[model samples]
Target: MLGNQKVVQAFAHEADAQEKFEDINEDLRVWSLKATFFSSITNPATRFVNSLVYASVGIAGAFAAVKGLLSVGQLSSFLSYANQYTKPFNEISGVITELQNALASAARVFELIDEEPEVPEKPDAAVLSNAKGEVSLEHVYFSYNPETALIEDMNLKVRQGQRVAIVGPTGCGKSTVINLLMRFYDVDSGSIQVDGTDVRHMTRQSLRTSYGMVLQETWLKSGTIRENIAYGRPDAAEEEIILAAKEAHAHGFIRRMPEGYDTIISEDGGNLSQGQKQLLCIARVMLCLPPMLILDEATSSIDTRTEIKIQKAFGKMMEGRTSFIVAHRLSTIKEADVILVMRDGHIIEQGTHDSLISQNGFYAQLYNSQFAV
Candidate 1:
């Protein structure tokens, strides 16, 4: 909530957020009070019991001493034993809050551990070795909820090394096409295939390894710059890593850092700007040099000049390799070999950019809408 304060303010939901925060704060306050009451109760009660025991022992010991029935040393020894007996209870009470927190965290961990994998790979699944990058989806049907349909009867085919661009309005299932191809979600019916072999028949690891993906939302682990770039192929040489960064136009900023490639990145690259993080993610893909590429608005965070440079780099990287580009900006996909314009989970039109624009259809209108006078 603190991180996205600007978003809350921008949407004019300050009061709504404040209400939520106050509710959470109230719950926390109640929990803390209960915990403090319980924890605080144990120690004082034990202390009072100890004091009473000491007082009784002292009085009895003094009486006994006066009658020469007990010695001073004997009373002192009994008092020491009492103190030792009560020490552990005090220690345990002090740690009650910590123990509660640990148990709560453990419960959450166990819950995650018990979750079943949605797309489990078969034990005898074939390895997709040296994929030729010929992909096809036939009569695909899928929906997150069974009652509501998303992608219905979708069909697509691409030969080796073809650049296919998917363009559509918001929520038109452009990203769903990428998800199906990647097998992130299994289709309800029909099969998605690569090189004439169904993806379900292949090992998920082998199938995913065939494509290098870069999403609009970049992900980077807490590691040095070099480690993130070489995440896919950890054995990548330093020179190869540098070359990839250079190609992605990330080297300049990376070199300017305090420790260059050795500088540690905060969790999820929090220390870096969004554009810089995207560039690093692109460099990671470049280093991997997979047989296929899936770019979903990969350059959206980048400036126009930087995007142009990255596009040229992408052009080189995509040479003779099958690539799927999911983009919102029509201008960026003008050079695509085939553009698939989707609407409501169906491909309404598929053709080259010039051909689609010449038709003056939905794609043309979308393109013109961006630059309308």
Candidate 2:
């Protein structure tokens, strides 16, 4: 049952599912034949046991009659009683195999119920409300394992409607300062506050709703284009959906399709290019227009020329919204209000682009290396 969801998410496609189905179907057929073979043999086996019991009683009766201890009519009646007893015994013996299979299935269900969840929700948790887009993280620390730390003693403050871009080399813990901001994972130490309320104090659902995210790993359900775009804002009108698509530079491509916004998208966007899928994700977030935004730029698949146009669409989306951007292409983040340069899970340098360039620090060196040909 869980495997079906993985197939729908495109970890495997329809062809793979078909192959698995045929394999399981063959196994089922063989198993059914085995059961039928056992069932067909069961009645004969019971009759053989019944005949043996009758023969043993008859031999004793013959001995008694020959010794003048019993009559022929009495011996026949004894044999008839033995046959009546075997009939009920034979009926019960037939269902033993089926009953064992049912008990084994029940045992599996009990095993699953005994397992515990990793993170249980807290009772009496409050709901986050009236988020004004201000986010602050102080003295944060986190680690996936005890031997290695991913984030340590991190502190940040962002006022409302600000754009902060994080840039770093590989393995620098650039796993979305944005993810932390949205409370995807809780920090081991320190507090993450949005609009002066700590995230842990509120329900995760309500807190996440206040933010809109567009990451490189874009996700959309298998449905019409319009449905994918309006996922976060399900009640959005057609005009609003089109406006959002236009703002994200997705409207043009969507219109040229055979059915426009009504066109169906295959799972994991098998029918669209990576760039096109990313644009649809952006459109989805735009429709919700959350007060906070997280944008992770995965530009490796995007051509330099194509990215220039996409960045323009991003600029308009970021306007007047508190956003955190993670980018490898330094050019896309040159205009950020603050650029944080991270190294090995630590923030090494931070400032505006020009200011960092003036310092000739880590940010400057990294930016120069990108253009070194």
Candidate 3:
């Protein structure tokens, strides 16, 4: 009885094991079937020919050994040898083909890794502290390409918290000034100073942390609306996020979103209108609460109604912070404390809106061409 009971227990265990094996085999079969279908579609001719040759060669060799008048030992040895040779040949062919593909992929990946970074940080760069937004450009010369100069010997200075507007024709390099200030590209000559310290002597990260930038192209990642707003300062509280959004005039539309703050935004915020995307970008910059702000055509893409809302938000954001506005819209910068009119990398005119119009120079011509209507 004891022996019988032990046997029964062992049989039960075996039955359970078989059931588990069958489930796993089913899963493997499903996976293999999908893989085979994909492989057939991708490499139909080669795979089919390889299979056909392997099968035919294996069968023909076996048939010859079995039917031909050969001694048992000789037949066994021949079959074993053929099997060994064919197995390795098949494996080697597959490995060689895969190795070629892997090498090609590795080459492309390594090329990217080998690329020299455009901006190199200094080994002993100083960290910036107590930045009061005083900025100066001393004999600054910059060129995007070696053959073309953008700004040359440009001298400008701004007191702390002063609003400066840069206006110019399409290629006059109005935006280039902001890029230089942010150290996006090093100047070919001269120097840019922030709060009396040369910007180049400060760590890039530390220098940029002092300013917030809003560009024409608003970049929004795919995430919850709150997540997008809180991106600049991740640890920002829920109330703080809401306040920043409200300040940017984004709270109204955000509240109307299907899930409000929890609403998941699409990449580039494609689901939202262009104006709404800009509002969110403004909100993101506002959340950073930097001491200085750069607005590059911030209102260019928005409708008049949305522009009004954004202008109000801009007014709030500009308070107590040094602001730089780069725009082709003359009306947008009319209220700027000082407007610098640039032409072919040269500042042709600099003054308040009324003063520039009185001078009737490049800026006056631009203003009249647009706003004089």
Candidate 4:
């Protein structure tokens, strides 16, 4: 919960972390005190109940002896026999109470076990093998909620090694198409095929491993530059790692660091600037060189000069690989073999950059809006 304070602070939420922390601390205190109180009483409570049982039996035996219905020696023997039974009864009660607490903890474990997965794998699914990177989405449909439909009847196709750009305003289902293609969420009514096989039929590892992705929001682990770049292919050679970083224009900055590529990044690359982190991410993907690529506004964080260099690296990376580019920056994908314009959960326009500009449609409006005086 203390970790949550960072997020609250980061977003400048009105909620008071200290106030919440005090309340939670009070709850913890109460819980701990209650547990300690229960534990402290267990043995004493058992002894108190044992004494009551013994006293009642002893009193009854003494009265019987006085009436000449029982001998003094017999009373002693009866009290001894009673202790054997009552002692176990007291111990068993304490054990039962302790087990109840343990069972409560076990129930939490079972809750995790009982949770249903969002995507269940098919029985006897085949591993996707020898992919040529021909991707197609045939009549796909999806919605996060029934009332707020996102993508409806979306169809797309990309021949092997082609670079296709998806352009649209936010919430126009461009990322949804990528999600469906990756099987992050299955389409409601249609199929996403990779290399002539439906994504559902292949192992998620197989399908995802075939694609190399670099997103606008870069994610990096706490590791050295070399380790982060070789994350995808951990066995990648040192020379190959350097080559990838050089290609992505990352090597120069990395070399200037105190330990060069050996410098360890702090959590989420906090030690680095946003553009530097993005360059590392691009280098990481470049090292892997998967047959298919997804660049989702991948250069948005970089300055114009860095973006130009990274774009050149991307040009090399996309060669002979089927690539999908999702960009709000029209210039980044101006040379794409196909440009798809999305609006209101549908593909409204499709063509080359020049062809789409010539048509003077939604794509033209979006492109022109970026440059409007």
Candidate 5:
């Protein structure tokens, strides 16, 4: 609500939002009513039963006393015993509702625990070390659903220290390429290799650590600026963190904050602007200086001026490091060592920007469409 309040109000969705809120409120109201009704009945029923028992004991005891069949002290002791026995039922009734809620929550938790993992690590997986950043996908086939074909017979090779840019329309497998390279999803019928070794044979941790990533959407946890910058390398020294922040052009803003690098950010960086969050994420990846990099529209959120600055910083960062850049903005990737244009999950055009544009094919058409007056 806080993040999107302006948007909601601008679109005149106040009524819709209120209606949804009331719907949730009504459901909760019904739930509370049911709980309250059950609780009220159980507690009062226990009390009523206890009271009736006490009344019966009193009346019978009085009759007995009148008939000289019971002592006053014995009658009082019997009444006290009956009260003690029924008191536990009242306590138990009070907690029955809470117990039911807890049991239902536990059942949901156990169901989540029992579900299978989508990507499981192997026990005997080899550790990828000192990678030269060579990557290749061989005759790859993958689909989210078994019956649907997303990517098929895909083949590509990326050499060490090369910058490969992927450009395509939405749902054309741009991000999926990054997922395959990162081993987030294994190819259905082929192999992805890094440094001549199949990725599946490498330990997931070691393979993932070899690459630094920055995405269009930024994610920052609740922490100080310094902590967020050092997320990828928690043990990074103060100097190292500051240097990376400087490289990413985030150090100036950090120092300007009320507490400098110590300024506490709210959850998901609610306290900071989108560009600031993106800069911090970029700083994190810069600090790691991984052998390979994956940048998925890394500068999309920044203004043009800031984007230019970040692109310069990214150019420096990508030096001698294999980088896979997935971007919708064609102009940002002109300097890429190789460009792969995808459509329908296939690499339809592959060349340098100038070479592909000269061919005057799909890549040329897309590029021209963007720059068309």
Candidate 6:
């Protein structure tokens, strides 16, 4: 773990260094190109001046030699030596300038290649065999920065196939809890265990493969509608893609498109409505069929009518799966098995919706403030 932290710090430092080097190198190249052009013009002028001097000397010598005042061999030798000397100097000067510029470019390119990855997976870490989705956080502590704790001494657990909702004000560490569970960032102290196995001991790829996520922002690559839905399982049969889309209530809009399943989606799915995009994201997650699902503000951006439709789709998707829903809309998660109210890196209250409402504590206040709307 110490080695891993060192590697992460080193990689971050290298990335910063590379960015600075590239910026400086780009400025150097531009200046070098202009310098080369000017040097080309200046070098010729210097050679021309040398040639004129040589020519004047040759003419004077030839005239004197013809009058028996100088020698033909001596004049020929002087002209030959001057041409030989200036030619090499002009070529070498240009070569040196060009070499400096090329060196700077090469340095920037190699620096980036030399950088290590920010997060490195262990070579022989165990692959999760059958994750039961039983997660536990024991006295967990975490912070994206050293001075402030995002989650501190927080303890929680969920049984297999449990549906939990985390609701709180923005920046109260609701997402941080999900990030910790996903192992996106390691805890500063304590342990996060999944199915009795410490999450840190599992390979990142296998750990993440156990859970599926649908974010508020639906990121769709430029591709056919069928391709986006089948993103999680590219080899899924055509019928499977159609089934998942239908479950998400996205089939109607997709069918109306000119090409149906084959319709091309613009980059980031810019052609689709916000609700349609969210539905597609849900469809993609459904195709993966992970044991655990994470919905991070999954319905925040859509219209109320569309939100209800997507929420229904989420209900169907969460059946029999261990699900974690992070949202600000309390009504959307009223049916969750457990609700956690967080504030300033701590879980201030947790229970079923009815229980928390009866307590009239932090959770009750939050619900009354927002759900009353």
Give residue 94's error in model 1 in angstroms.
Answer: 19
Poorly placed runs, candidate 6 (over 4 Å): 1-42, 45-86, 114-116
Would you list the C-alpha lDDT of every candidate in the order shown? Answer: 0.92, 0.84, 0.84, 0.89, 0.91, 0.86
Question: Residue-wise lDDT of candidate 3 within 1-373, one digit each (tens)?
Answer: 2335567576777676668779999999999898666544544554565667657755666677688755566656765675665565556555554666688899999999999887677788888866789999999999989898789999999988889999988888978898999999898899999988888988998899898988888899999999999988999999999999988888999999899999998896869988788888889998988898899988777777777767777877788788899987777778889899889999999999999999988777888888654
Cα lDDT tens digits for candidate 1, 232-311: 99999999999999999999999999999999998769789999999999999999989999999999999999999999
User: Per-residue lDDT of 8-80 in model 6, one digit per residue for the tens?
Assistant: 5767766766677799999999998997777577667677777887889888888988998778898788778
Considering every candidate listed, which one attains the maximal lDDT?
1
> Could you give the C-alpha RMSD of every candidate to the true structure, in order shown?
6.5, 5.0, 16.2, 2.4, 4.4, 9.5
In candidate 6 the C-alpha lDDT for residue 135 amounts to 89
- When sorted by lDDT, best at the front, the candidate numbers are 1, 5, 4, 6, 2, 3
Model 2 pairs whose backbones collide: none
Q: What lDDT is obtained when candidate 5 is compared to the true structure?
A: 0.91
How does each model score on TM-score?
0.76, 0.78, 0.72, 0.91, 0.80, 0.78
Steric overlap count per candidate: 0, 0, 0, 0, 0, 0
TM-score winner between 5 and 6, please give it.
Answer: 5
lDDT score, candidate 6, position 38:
77
Higher-scoring candidate on TM-score, 2 or 4: 4
List, residue by residue over 1-373, the lDDT tens digit for candidate 2. Answer: 3546665556656677668888999999999999888977887799889999999999999999999999999999989989998988788767767776789999999999888753555787777766778888889888767699888888888988899999998777777466677777778888888888888877888889988887878788999999999999899999999999987778999999999999999878888999889889888987998777888774445678767877887788778888888889898999999898898888999899999999999988998999889
lDDT of 5 by residue, 81-158 (tens): 989998998898878878888999999999999998766667788899878999999999998889889999999999
Candidate 4 lDDT trough over 10 residues, lowest sum: 12-21
Pairs of residues at least 3 apart in sequence or in different chains that clash in candidate 4: none
Worst 10 residues of 6 by lDDT: 1-10
Task: Give the winner by lDDT: 1 or 3.
Answer: 1
